[model samples]
Target: MIIGSSERVPLEKCPALVLNADFRPLSYYPLSLWCWQDAVKSVFLERVSIVSNYKRKIRSPSFEMSLPSVIALKNFIKPTEHPSFTRFNVFLRDKFTCQYCGDKKDLTF
Candidate 1:
């Protein structure tokens, strides 16, 4: 999953959608994935990257390289934003105990 110098720019620092051979949308691929795979041939793009010269190349340390030089698939939907209320919920979920130091205190005047 190693992203080459070329692919880094067009992704716009965002995750990419990976599709199967059947063209069925599969899952999101982070930039790190490209770095991990080293090379990817399965790429289908809905909207091509506007930036020219954005070619992704993946290479394996074991002397293996994928074909198609990695495809630049379409951008997926944005992740849902976490609700602000979840912050408070998290505190209550852990009780009054300090998250770092699981201490339970009952203060009295």
Candidate 2:
């Protein structure tokens, strides 16, 4: 949809952070994010509940709403038995400490 003739923030930059049914982020490593288009579609489809919103507003002939900064699912997807193996998850499990030297600074994989 064509939007924002005068607004300074690019629509591309206004991604919404997606959350689980329990109000926790859907993911942390890469972050479960949705683009403005998908986020707006989900709003119309009522698949998510808005948790927070940006100051910007989007309008149509029939309706208008502030752009969502955060949204949560209406349904909960149960977590799998085992968490996926990701570098961020590994770092979290390790408590961000060096596995070999126990150093807590400048960690790198």
Candidate 3:
């Protein structure tokens, strides 16, 4: 989708949505996104492939290129399995500390 903007678009609005090599979002909960600078760096490094572009383009002394709206990694990265939703995991996340009371002596669910 093309977003209309003025002569110059702000850098904050040019965040590139990062996707895996499989064309899926790297992170769904947080929504993987990289700034314009990182996106351009990745493109130059050949570490990522551009999937889509934004209407705005950035100009530099050497080159000028359109900002990428969506980018996928060139190499596929194995996805980490989700942690099991268990009481032990919950306790581990909490660092064995009591959530309700400040009592660190006894912690139980």
Local lDDT at 62 for model 2: 90
Poorest stretch of ten by lDDT in candidate 2: 1-10
lDDT (10s digit) by residue, model 3, range 1-109: 5544444779887899999999999876458999989999999999999988888888989998888888999998888798667776777778877788856676666
Worst lDDT run of 10 residues, candidate 1, spans 45-54
Tell me the tens digit of each residue's lDDT in model 1 across 1-109: 4434544454333334334334443433222234222223232223322222223534557653323323443555444475345544565666656676677664211
Please report the TM-score between candidate 3 and the true structure: 0.70
Candidate with best TM-score: 2
TM-score of each: 0.22, 0.72, 0.70
lDDT of 2 by residue, 2-64 (tens): 233336888899899999999988776779999999999998899999988887888899998
Model 2 TM-score on a 0 to 1 scale: 0.72
The per-residue C-alpha lDDT of model 3 at residue 77 equals 82
Model 3 has a clash total of 0
- How do all the candidates rank in terms of TM-score, highest first? 2, 3, 1
